[model samples]
Target: MTEIRWLEAFVAVAEELHFGRAALRLHTSQSPLSQTIRKLENDLGTRLFERNTRSVALTSAGHALLPRAYRVLQDMRLAREAALAEVEGVRGKILIGFSGAVNHLTLPPLTRAVRRRHPDIELDLTSRVRTRDGLASVANGTLDLAFVGVAESPDPSVVARLVAREEIGAVLPLDHPLAREKSIPLQSLAGDDFISPPTDGSSSMTEVLLASCMAAGFRPRIVQELSDPYMVLTFVAAGVGVTLMSSGISSIIPSGATYVPLDAPHHYMNHAIAWSADNDSAVLKAVLDVVEEVFPPVAS
Candidate 1:
């Protein structure tokens, strides 16, 4: 059977038209180079070159085969590079999921960094996935990675790397009595009705709210549970009730609502990049490397 070295020898000699010069180009002794070419000619049943002590030239068969041989060598090089690129995590498609404020605050920089560093890798982003759903997708291999709001992933099959932790704060109607305070104690709002998002099994804003309120020795009376955070804020603005939220999302507080940081012994909501522990994807690792560079984990 034909081999790659045989093709290399043939191309080098065909191009140089001199066995000695081709051997130097190939970093091999002329004798082996000549033998390789002879083996290739014998395999093909054709004389590819005609040579005498004084000169060397390609036979008609060699002239016809030169371009084809060149293509074979070039294609082999490209094939090896493609394989290496995949092995090195520099190429492939990654499915990434994002949700809530992390979609704006954390995802952008990570996405940009991945794009810049691994331009050949394709990123397919799915937005608005909640923490639990994102975690589920990642664990099941549907999503290669997910940016979510959670101190740590509750899913045992996944690993979460903390990206950013923002202090928990309260959003109240601008006219609410506690809004007057620049910062409010968590227990101070226990008497007020609250509006919040519904809690799921995973770490979520509602979990944070309930935990913070309980830590402060009161149960928040959530009068309404809404899925859309903006709508929940709108309810707060309408004087429906107050809600606890991460300061990272404070920017979206409606005009009628005011955000006040929760007083001392600050509670924080965490954003993390989660991936399945089972997934050892090189592309995912490449993206995670960029995540580390962009948002290194901080002490929580």
Candidate 2:
């Protein structure tokens, strides 16, 4: 019978794609790791890896087994944690994925709450641009939760709970004429140079800004496109151009920039917390409860 030890060794080697590195991660020598992997392959009667002098890669069989093996390992880990929690009355880790913008507005408070409420629960946070990708990570058991924008409906496999909402606005140089207006009409800035966020099919802000401009009957003359909102605002403060932004971002506005709200009917953005529907960990549930208490959903 193939031992659990061999399965773990195979997984480590498959993930690292190198025997030496896999051995390092496993805290064992390369020779034993290699021997265990060979034994696993022999027991399974198939080659799991394609090895060469320069590189190592998973064979077709290995690729097919990877996801299943990962799930087994995850289940075992959860089981161990459950056993420990039963003995000590607390324990486990929750992985959180988020976007850059969400980090500024939501993550700090949520993390503080988690730390205060459940210090025994380890929290791991990662940043990513695409909310969909984050949701997928949760679905695949990679992430326990995610902080995402509520611009679109999420997948059925994931459950999203609204966290916060704020009005969208334009950021301009302090000296710009539009900065004088308390609320600027989107049409008023026609013909003005604009700096748009990059088109990565991830930033809902990009689509919202473009659509707002189109609704106002003008295609913005985009002079620059950037990935980071702070960078775009910096460019605006330098008089490079004007850019649309959310009120949550006002905290990061550069010294020379002023944020002005947009007029009625076109000025709001929603933020949400997402997690896998299948995940029912106490830590994730506790975090969700705190988020809901802090940022209740708004009716659209």
Please report the candidate that would top lDDT against the real structure. Answer: 1
User: Residue by residue across 1-300, what tens digits does model 1's lDDT show?
Assistant: 259989888888886799999999889998998899999999999999899999999999999987677556545544554687856736877889876543577888888888898898888887667788888777756678988776445568798888888899999899999888888888899899999887664537788889899999999998998776778888999999999888877776779998999889788888888898767666777888888899976786
Give the TM-score (vs. native) of candidate 2. Answer: 0.76
Model 1 scores a C-alpha lDDT of 0.81
Task: Residues 1-300, candidate 2: write the lDDT tens digits.
Answer: 257688789888987899999999899999999999989899899999999999999999999988777677667666777787777755688888877753587888888887887788888887754566666667666678877666454557787777777778889898898898889898888978999777666666777788778888898899898876678888999999898888888887888998899887676666777787666566667777777766756775
Give the TM-scores of the predictions, in the order they appear: 0.66, 0.76
Clashes by residue pair, model 2: none
Global lDDT scores for all candidate models: 0.81, 0.79
Q: Give the least accurate 10-residue stretch of model 2, judged by summed lDDT.
A: 148-157
User: Which parts of model 1 are misplaced by more than 4 Å?
Assistant: 1-89, 151-155
